[model samples]
Target: MPSPADTLTSDEPVGPQLATPPAISIQDLRIDYGSHLAVDNMSVDIERGVIYGLVGPNGAGKTSTFKALASLLKPTLGKIYLNGHDIVTHQRLAQANIGYMPDMAPVASDLKVWEFLDMFAGAHGLSGKEKSTRIDECIALVDLHSEYHAMCTSLSRGMMQRLVLAKTLLHRPSLLILDEPASGMDIKSRVGLRNILRNICKSHGATVLISSHILPELTEMCDEIGILHKGHLLDSGPVHDVLHRMTGLLPEIKIRLAEPPDMHWKEWLLAQEYVSNILGEDATHFSFHFEGEESDLAELLRRMITQGYLACRVSERQRSLEEILLDLEYDGH
Candidate 1:
């Protein structure tokens, strides 16, 4: 398969996040439909001022969990706390602390973008100059200043999604819970969403919990990630650590010879036990899977140098989050 070189893939742009008390805490969370359980005994802790991605397949209960958090669905058992308030008991306060944007957002064709934001701002108790000021701030926050006065119905799908996001942020929520926010967005729109969310986490220090089928974008946008499957939380941690522990994934390594080697380099590599799934036989670059001892790679490098291969560079390449997650599914995890 051709690699997604044009896709945004990085853990660097989001920057450093220090550990803090849990902004979101759940214990023994369960949601059931009659006798059917959508989520069972799933628990997770999302830190303050961090963007946590909840990744899973369609039936993995991602949306169910989000609904429970937003107070739209009551849990059968267990507790969820948002910014220190219990969601069940202090429902109104918890809801106030959270800004939830579901997969489908409601935007009126009759009103302009700012008017829609103004309506929500007033509903949230903002009035007079404060409401107007906050509306403008939110419009700018979502990078919708150019369309500030435009009719909401005339916007593109991406712009409409962004407008909904501005409305969600108008109340200055302490926690943001978004489900499939980029569902119908273009590549440029997806990248723009990534940047906006990252800035929100860094500058505003708000806790965010988001899920998207766009795994590649999640890798670039989130500070931590939780993988859920069949209503179970498989793993959760910082992106780099989760990527490393993603099903004992073997990282691919490439060895580049200074020149086309006429010697027996291919034969030597093929003979190695850990060097399986070799990709190419080109004289310049040889790539293979390496799951052996880390020390073995050093030994292999020395041997290659001694064999007159003139090793110019040896580097490791990891598969993307999507690749690793696919393997995880095939393995029934």
Candidate 2:
């Protein structure tokens, strides 16, 4: 298997330029529905030409934040900027550079796929030849050429999603905000959607903010991730950096034995001075949850060796986004 570092360069173009301003920026944003706060004071910046994963549990305000960014919902407080234009003060300009897909399909079911995209292209000011060219480009971009003449209602869920994406891309927006783009998609459709998104961000220099409940899937596609919980921005940064920061207090060490250790081994692990919990266990394997400075990991390993237990494999475990979110929610209380 290739290392994470190996995957890093796969998506980046050779000699890709750097130093572009953020494509999306949010500062101390807040939103409310009646007396209930749906989005707390949150802030994040998304760089140009990168795919960012906006993740949270249901009711974590993921939809609310996306709506505000798309200018569909007016925020009660805070500001949103897209491609350097303030969304609130410069609504049209900000919106012009954004293509937003809501959590639900917004297509006219009776319209054919091509007509649906053409309608949006016209609305975005495409003229006779320009409209035809842009519509063809979008259809090819989403790999929907075969379904161009199919009625929206006759299309499968996944095809409808692709058509909607084609509609969103009609104006060639620099930034795309997709809220649960894979909600009702099958495995094949989801894979197709992800591939289309990856191509857009990689080949076209477009930035994307995609929200999803599937952590593993997001981890595979996103360049960075922002985790939200209970209306709070728990963490935001490069995926690995955020995971490292969140798990800094707990060391993830895995141990392998020559043979299956006895129950005494579990007791001995828990009794260690720095160890807090035994997170996972299996035959010939165990994971330790250690607290305090990471430098103590060496000392813990030395002690384990000195204790006469044959430790075959010992290494820190990588924290998952789900684990970080759980810790954040529990820690705040």
Candidate 3:
């Protein structure tokens, strides 16, 4: 993508280039639908020049929160500030600072790629040389120059996604809010989307708030992550911090045996309170996530040996961050 830092200046006119505050800020934000409370009083601050991943199960209020940030949904309570302007009171400035993309967007089949982009540029208040330059920049940024003149209907799903993103960037908004951007994308398309997002953060100095159910992908791509459930934000922080907070002393131990274990061994292992996500290739070896004191683990192993499980070796291993996060969810229950 073209470095908007140099080519584009702040839309501010009367004053010199002023420093922007944290890209997004929410204080005691609450959203509701009729009698149903969607998002409770949740507050979060997101910095610029990085990706923030928001993950939660269905009906977790992720979409409602995003719509409020995008100014599409009115919040029943609290304040939302974008680029130092209140989203509700300073609607124009807030809108100018945000580029929001929903899970699904329209791509007119009858329009050519450049024409589609040109239409958006005009909508964003660009004209003449600036419009042409911006359209070209967006096309090249998403690597869509080859399809510059191609019809929108002829593009693939991945191509269409990239195109929608390009449309979002036409105005050079300081914040990008995306909801399930990679939904239904194939592996190749997903990878492409990831790379593009990374490039935009580093090159454009934009703040991104993205939500998805794909835990591994978010773990790999985001600088910070928030876990939400039932409209409540349970936790939010850097990836490592969130993982550590999930389990103060949790450890994953792999067990191997010289011979097969007794029929009741599996049942006994599951009956223990601190065991979960057991994985094994065969009867002789297995691993499970454990959250308990070291002495408690040893006691369980000793009991297993006495019960004829016949554990030959036990070693510790690292589990996926998502696995640990899941453990936290279960613990919350």
- Judged by lDDT, which candidate is best? 1
lDDT tens string, model 2, 29-133? 999999999999998888899899988766889999999999989999988878766687667767767899997766797888888877888788888998999
Give candidate 2 regions above 4 Å deviation.
1-20, 247-252, 258-270, 276-283, 307-310, 322-333
Better of 2 and 3 by lDDT: 3
Clashes of each: 0, 0, 0
234 in model 3: Cα distance from truth in Å?
0.7
- Candidate 2 minimal-lDDT segment of 10 residues: 8-17
Candidate lDDT scores, in order, read 0.82, 0.80, 0.81
Candidate 3 lDDT for residue 207: 87
Those runs of model 1 whose alpha carbons end farther than 4 Å from true positions after fitting are 1-20, 247-249, 306-310, 328-333
lDDT of 1 by residue, 167-249 (tens): 88888887999998997788987888888788888888888999998888898899999988878888899988887777464
